[model samples]
Target: MLTPEEWAIVALSLRVSGVAMAVTLPVAFGLAYLLSRGRFPGRSLVDAVVHLPLVLPPVVTGWLLLLAFGRNGPVGGWLEAAFGVSVIFRWTGAAIAAGIMALPLMVRAIRLSIDAVDRRLEGAARTLGAGPWRTFATITLPLCLPGVLAGLVLGFARSIGEFGATITFVSNIPGETRTLPIAIYSALQIPGNDDAVWRLAGLSVALSLAALVVSEWLARRGQDDRAGHVL
Candidate 1:
């Protein structure tokens, strides 16, 4: 049986990961679309910047976020002063850190999906008098739905497993910013918490496996759809 605290951690993890994925999806789609289809100055730079979090140390990324969103920081200060909002040492900061960390995987998956789309098909729609938004809604989005699902699952997994950046940005606060990974880390720091660690570790492994399975299922489903389209 799971303890109340464990259940709280699990529920909070789900909430944080869900929120992160929700916010990241549209931004990921936009970046993927730009990378796959748009052409303009500094495109390469933009691409590099989008994937920077993937390469940088998690701690460094967290520190940067703190500088940008901490209580004393300009953006954070203005937000607090204007709307009484706060991100530092809070759940919101954890979600932001997780989302940023998950962004590269999200963008990569969606960009590949977008690239696989048939431009000729889009052209046909345009020839038939459909505007860009209309064609994208009816054609492009449907074709890439599986990819979007895959990206969302992958991003959710990443967010749930986030640790270094989240800890740096929000610290470990039970029922607030302490997520699954942080809980696991906290378990490790105490003596005779091996059982707790193992239990949490099991949950983490199961979550990761489920994410992988779903992602693969979505990929296969996308492939079948593509085959049908080709036929």
Candidate 2:
């Protein structure tokens, strides 16, 4: 017997994760493009920092976010002063934490795809009177759709399961920051809620598996579409 609150938590988790992925995709793609195609100083350092969250413990990432985005912290203070808003202990904050954790995976996937794209195709587009942005939009982007889809799906799935960073930064307040992972954690904390935990855990597993399947399907479909375009 699932309560309304639990179901709400599940829906909210999906929403937050979806939004996080949506928010991360463009930024990831742009960064990936820059890393793949742009020749710039400090590029290596930028790449390293982008992947830092992937290597660091989620809790540590959360702590860094807290330090940087907390009310008294510099950037956080500026944001608050400028917008009269706060991210700490909020749903938005949880999404940001999850997004940071998932960004490296997203960027890596997009970067690889971009790298694999045929540069000659882009050059051909330039020869046909296309600007850099036009070539990217028409040729590079279409060819790399599979990787972009993969990155989006991966980031969304990761965001769904986000726990340590979210809890550390957002504090797991029920109905606000209590996402699916937080809900599962809360369920396990109760002595007689093993069945509930099992149910939610099953749901979580199903969601993750579904996301994986969707990613694969989208990747394959993108490949097929590209192949057809070539034909």
Candidate 3:
């Protein structure tokens, strides 16, 4: 019973969230690994910086992003001049906003998994002539796969639900930046648009719930798998 426009909005939301998660996954893993294992100076500072968006107002985050990545901003200007790329007011910008908003959750989940890994096992692998990179690839990453996947799901859910940051960065342009949350907000502004609001809101709830359920299932399955492996 959804209209074509509604379906389009849903599709756009999925695309933005999916792309955001995909783009953030590797970066999140790297940061998680660093935070969980590295002992470099300024580590606390780095961690705080990484988690800043979580505590900062969404509008503030969005405005900061605008300052950093808007056409006139240094990074954005460089990108535009050197690569002819412009993310401002585009779907790409929306993806960036979603990714930033979801990063802390992703990093935290992955970091916890990394911290739970057995350092002794890594040492054993090293004793067997496995290099750090090799051991990480063969042991650490596999052990933490479940957490990484859970993080991705959680991040995807966050991305889909993103509103304030996305709206500020991308302006809710239809067929571009108007995700499900934005669509719902749009519907709410007009009179007698209850049906549209309800439909979009329902879809949003379903998607978020589905993501959380999957994340939980993945975490539980991971625990079971680790237990069986130990046995």
In order, how many clashes per candidate? 0, 0, 0
lDDT of 2 by residue, 49-144 (tens): 999998899889999999989999987899899999999998888888888888998999888888878788888899999999998789988889
Distance from true position, residue 45, model 2, in Å? 0.9
Clashing pairs in 3: none
Which candidate tops lDDT? 1
List the candidates' TM-scores in order: 0.97, 0.94, 0.96
Flag regions of model 3 displaced more than 4 Å.
Answer: 228-231
Which regions of candidate 2 deviate over 4 angstroms? 222-231
Judged by lDDT against the true structure, how good is candidate 1?
A: 0.93
Q: What is the lDDT of candidate 2?
A: 0.88
Model 1, runs deviating above 4 Å: none
lDDT of each: 0.93, 0.88, 0.92
Candidate 1 has its poorest 10 consecutive residues by lDDT at: 222-231
Candidate scoring better on TM-score of 2 and 3: 3
Ranking by lDDT: 1, 3, 2
